[model samples]
Target chain A: MNLTDQQRTLIEQIGVWHENNGIQPAAARVMGLMIVSDKRELTFDEITEALSISKSATSNALNLLLRTEHLEYITFPGDRKRYFKMKISNWREAFTRKIDDLTGFNVLLRQVLEVRNRNCDESDEGLQDFISFLDYLHQELPNLLAKWEEQNKKS
Target chain B: MNLTDQQRTLIEQIGVWHENNGIQPAAARVMGLMIVSDKRELTFDEITEALSISKSATSNALNLLLRTEHLEYITFPGDRKRYFKMKISNWREAFTRKIDDLTGFNVLLRQVLEVRNRNCDESDEGLQDFISFLDYLHQELPNLLAKWEEQNKKS
Candidate 1:
């Protein structure tokens, strides 16, 4: 699959952004390519040829993406080869997971507060305020996700 | 500034978490210390001594934290040394800034959609759905933050 210069630039920019966010260069490049591909899906050989990456590199990148739920593969009738595409819902799930993890950490923070209360004088109003903020977020994030789901369903 | 065994374990655990998130170990240690400190404020020497980090490492970590607004310092009347404390509000600001950046990215995605619409057959329902999801988030995230603020005010 030949890429226009503009498409190439966009792919490279996406790759750079993912790399900045700590993804490996090859996997990031694959993700970038997958996002901007006109077909919205590509075979393994096509991905390797388009990105000019080695077979092993392509396989590794694809496997990582699949393991992380960032990409999914499909097979058509009578087609032995698999075709891969971006999993857009996975992006939403990733954000949701981050919020969930923070909420889980709030439980730990509450336990820490109990310990602090037992061990120290109850004078650190700032610490108390911070805990209160975390508690507020813990209660609100689920509702926020629910609201997004409700809006998404309407749209 | 001596730490109990439990405190030491907690600090180390926090440092490991930060390291996994791509933060430097020294800076992560400083963050952990600041969070659990009974004093709520510490001088340069105090941070170094408590964390067992070298003076140069302490300075570098403190400077990074200060630059990122994760920590702030103040000087007392007639005192030459600065006392530093964790900036809990910065954590809130960081979350706010993340939502803002995502909202900003929605504009870029809209442009991408326009270009894609012109260049492609517009058969990619998945792409359109992803864009719609982003648009929903762009509209809804501010309300989530506002709701958090209202709840915080009440509590």
Candidate 2:
């Protein structure tokens, strides 16, 4: 399949950034190929040929995507080759992880604010302003997750 | 200030991961320091001394944090040295970036599913099942974000 230059650039950007952030670039490519392909699940051969990467690279990339739970592997009764398709059932986990990461940061941030406020007498209005926001965010996280889970159950 | 061994190990983990992911280890160190320090903001010398890194390393780390908008610079009128503090005014932005990142992946995943679903003939139940989740995830994202944002606003 032919991709426009803009599409190709976007794929490259996603690949490189994800790689730089400790994820594999080829996984990003496999993701890119599958997303734009006329067919959703692609075999290793198709992916390798499409991305012009080595078969080993394609193999490794696909494996990593599977390992990360972002994609799934499918085997047919009569087919020798395995097929990969995006895993959407676990999307809630992805969102949860995002919230969890922010929550993690907030835990650290709140402690800092607490100590700073306690020691400095809370005279700095800027500090108090930022502190109030952190406190509010920290307090709100659990309710937000509960609400999201409620919505998830409905749909 | 001395960090406990456990705290040091956690800091090291964060530092190494960020470094491998293209962020400088010292940048991660600065982030760690700010998170745990009694004072939220730190001067260049304080960061250097606290992290046991060089002044230049502290400067570079602080600059990286500034670029990411994770931390900001502060100036007191009488003091020539710059102070840096974590930007906690909008914790939602940090979480939102994660949502945006997922959106990027979701968009690509949806495209792949569309293409592959088309190629899977009526008899190919396995391939169709393999990609079904992508469509579901694409549909859920808008509602998820709206709920999260609504909670964020209420908080």
Candidate 3:
């Protein structure tokens, strides 16, 4: 489907945000388009035209997105084209990983603490404090997720 | 102070991790060195030699890390040389921003929902559901942080 001016503008805005977050430009725009496009699913050609991107670029971006679980595909009974759709539901895993990564440093922080000289007591204590703080966050995330889900069900 | 083989290896590991997260290589290594070093602080020449990085590259990385608040500098009464130190304390704020950025999408999500064609029901509802999920997370973060702090005090 052809995009409206508003849709095109929104795509760029979303695209820029994703690109700044380290996603390559083509892949970022493709994801932005999938979210903003009116159609629930798009053929490979539709994605290419919507973003005005090259075929190889679109193919590469699609592969990256699919591999990353941001997008998924389906084939119809008689259709030769693959329909790509958003797998945003999987974002809970992605978002959870982002939060977990905060606490994930505990492992390395411990490693860091292990090798420090005993004379660097202050900073060593600082590292230990940070580790406990991260451990607290890690333990508490499940509680937060449960709370978010519980509230989500209510509303 | 010269970095030990163990320290150098740790620096490389930490530097690689930071670089994967989009930090420039020189800046990443410099930050890693500051964290793993035995000294609480390092001077300009020291950072350069320790990293075996060029003067210009070291200078740029120092400026980047200092500006980003990951490192800070000090001046001594008699010493002309500046001593740069770790500011890992500021990371809590950085981590807070990371959490906030997940929910930060609500503003843009609402905008995306606003302009979508009414017929695009499934994806629109999907976006709406995602927004509310994010809203729940946003509302609940402070409570999680408070809980973490509370638990930290008990232990």
Candidate 4:
């Protein structure tokens, strides 16, 4: 499908930002394309040809999305080509899992500090300061999440 | 700073996941390092030297973190070197802003859809469906944010 000049520029902007942020732009591109396309599900060839990226790049990118539970694969009863679609199925599940992952990582950090702190003398100001930082995160994250929810409700 | 074999492996695992997800591993590494390190703030050269990456990479990555408001830089009165530290100042701000950016982009997509949908009529079910998908995102994000907050509190 031919993209207008404006659409082309917008796509490039999104791609660059995604790349910089450490996300594969292809998935976002695919999402954009699927959302804008006349057809909801396009073949592998169509995706590669449209994005001008390699098939492997598209495949790897899509695979990551699927693994992260962001996208799902589809097959029409008679159609041979598999189709892909975004899963907004549970936005709560999608976003919360990521946040939970971050929190879990924080908990691991606290454990490390606990073990290490015990081995060190109380005079180790450096270690104490670092542990304090983790403690701050532990306390702050819950409130932050609450604020996001409140803002969400207001909006 | 020499890392144990186990530490190195763990770092690499986290790095790969961040890279795959489109986030720079350096930021993740830095966060990981902070969690494990005895020291709180690491100098620019120290992070670069520890990660075995170029100084520019460290600088750019740290600057990006600073811009995102996830990190802060401080200069001690006696020390000439600038030190970087993680800031848990506004976890909600960091995430809410990103969601806001996504919402803003949808506003543009909606404009494009208005034009595209009107022109396609019955022939373009895919395009219409795509627009609906975005419309769903627009509607559901705030609700998701609320749920995210509740989950955070329970944790």
Candidate 5:
């Protein structure tokens, strides 16, 4: 599908945003194309042509996106081609995973704190406070996710 | 001050973690050194010696960490040297900034949804759901932070 000039600009902007977030340029461009595509779902050839990226770059980007749950594919009856769309669910999943990481990190911090506390005469107040903050986040994240799920149910 | 072999290993591990998260190795090493330092504060020369990093690399890393609020400095009344330590407050600040970024991204996504909705015949349920998720996060993040602050005050 041919992209209009305006669409091209929007894609470029999205690409910049993703690139700033540490995504490689080619993969980010593919993501940009997928997000702004009017067709919603695009085949491999469609993505490659629309983004003007090499076949290998497109393949690698698609593979990365798929592995990371940033993209998913759809197959229609009797159709050999797989159509891909952005995995919007992955947005929430990404946040959820981040919360989990924070939890894990907090746990590790606590272990470190335990060892430090055992060895030291003076308490590390800063580390203690940071742990408190992490604990608060760990406790609140689940409640927040629950509220979101409740709202989703209502909607 | 000299680092023990164990301390060196710990610092390297932290550096690796930060590098995986897209932080430069030098900055990550600085962060790791700050975290594990028994004194909790280190001068420029101390950091350079402990990490075995070059003067220029240490200088650049410290500057980046200072600018990012990841590190802060203190001075004794008679001492000319500024001693640096990790900023625990910045941990919460980082999470707060992330919430803000999510809020901003959500607003941009909503605008995209509006334009896409206007142009397309079918509603993009995935985009709508993602927006809903963002809205839920936007509403909840402040309350979570407030609760943490309240708990902090009580403690």
Candidate 6:
């Protein structure tokens, strides 16, 4: 069996995973295609062909991935075409940023709560619970990660 | 100003927030309305009037909330109408369940990784990074929460 056939399920799985995380379907498919491809670097035409997606869709998906810094392109010294590959080194930063970004969301939740209280005889109880939970996460998630790092260093 | 006018922005904000989290817009608006209402318990007609949504939309949203256990109904001894209210008691469980749910996602990611390797000369680097990150979280997040509980008790 060919590489594509072998990885069809993987590609579909990753595509669904990305879609669940709120990525556009086409872009998610592109992400999955990149992940499972044996040929690490693929040009525009190659990506389009491998995914059975149109040029317009491939272009759009590529741009989205580029903007998100998940993928980057390289050019051969004499070649005009760009070959795209995953930006693997920044995985740690990207994952940590997801946690840090919650701080901003928590601030918004606080604001939401204040506004909710204005029209409420009894403020929303679930909102209060959610805010406190996020606050605890803000205070303690970093400490947890740091402790993990410390333990790993010692071990 | 009436309660609904006062909460217009809060409702919109929450509606958008839930939409971003992948909830349907109508259901999200209903969730928001429940959070900001001056009246803790609302009948079907009241929910419909406040949101200006169609009867069907209101009914569907209410049912969705009910199924998720985010909202529940209460009835007086002689009154027939059910009054829908937010389920305030299970906030901690709802929030912590989110973290526990990641275990299921991580398991799927492992399976996805295995399948991807079948077609690949080199495995996906980012997938490897993400698995490690989740593995770290799985190992240490509970410990971190436990430590926080202990510290609170001592203080």
Q: In model 6, which regions exceed 4 Å deviation?
A: A1-4, A117-127, A150-155, B4-6, B116-126, B146-155
Lowest-sum lDDT 10-residue window in model 6 chain A: A116-125
lDDT of each: 0.75, 0.63, 0.82, 0.61, 0.78, 0.74
lDDT of 5 at A118: 28
What is the DockQ ranking, best to worst? 3, 5, 6, 1, 2, 4
Name the lDDT of candidate 4.
Answer: 0.61
On lDDT, the leading prediction is 3
Q: Residues A16-43, candidate 6, lDDT per residue (tens digit)?
A: 8788878898888787777676666789
lDDT of 4 by residue, B31-147 (tens): 555444545567888888878888888888888778766678789898999887767445446555666665665565565555333344654443344445445554555565566
Candidate 4: residue B86 lDDT (0-100): 62
Error of 2 at A34 (Å): 1.8
Pairs clashing within candidate 3: none
Tell me the tens digit of each residue's lDDT in model 2 across A1-155: 56656556556665665665567678877776665555667788888887899989988988888888878979999899888887745555764565565456445444444443335555344444444554555455556555545654675
lDDT tens per residue, model 3, B1-155: 76678888888888887876778999999878888888888999999999988999999999998888888999999989999998867767777787677655667788888877757476576678788878877777777777766877787
Q: Residues B1-155, candidate 1, lDDT per residue (tens digit)?
A: 87777677677776766665557899998987877666777999999999998999999999998988889998999999999988866766877766666665555455455444334555555566666766666666667667766876776
**Candidate 1 residues A52-84, lDDT tens each?**
999999999999999988899999999999999
Give candidate 5's error at residue B155 in angstroms.
Answer: 5.1
The model with the greatest DockQ is 3
DockQ of each: 0.34, 0.25, 0.58, 0.14, 0.43, 0.39
Candidate 4: stretches off by over 4 Å: A1-23, A45-79, A88-93, A115-155, B1-23, B42-70, B76-78, B90-92, B118-155
Q: After superposition, how far is residue B154 of candidate 1 from its true place, in Å?
A: 3.4
* Candidate order, lDDT descending: 3, 5, 1, 6, 2, 4
State which candidate, 1 or 2, has the greater DockQ: 1
Per-model TM against the reference: 0.85, 0.67, 0.94, 0.58, 0.89, 0.84
**Candidate 2, clashing residue pairs?**
A34-B112, A35-B111, A35-B112, A38-B115, A39-B115, A39-B116, A40-B115, A40-B116
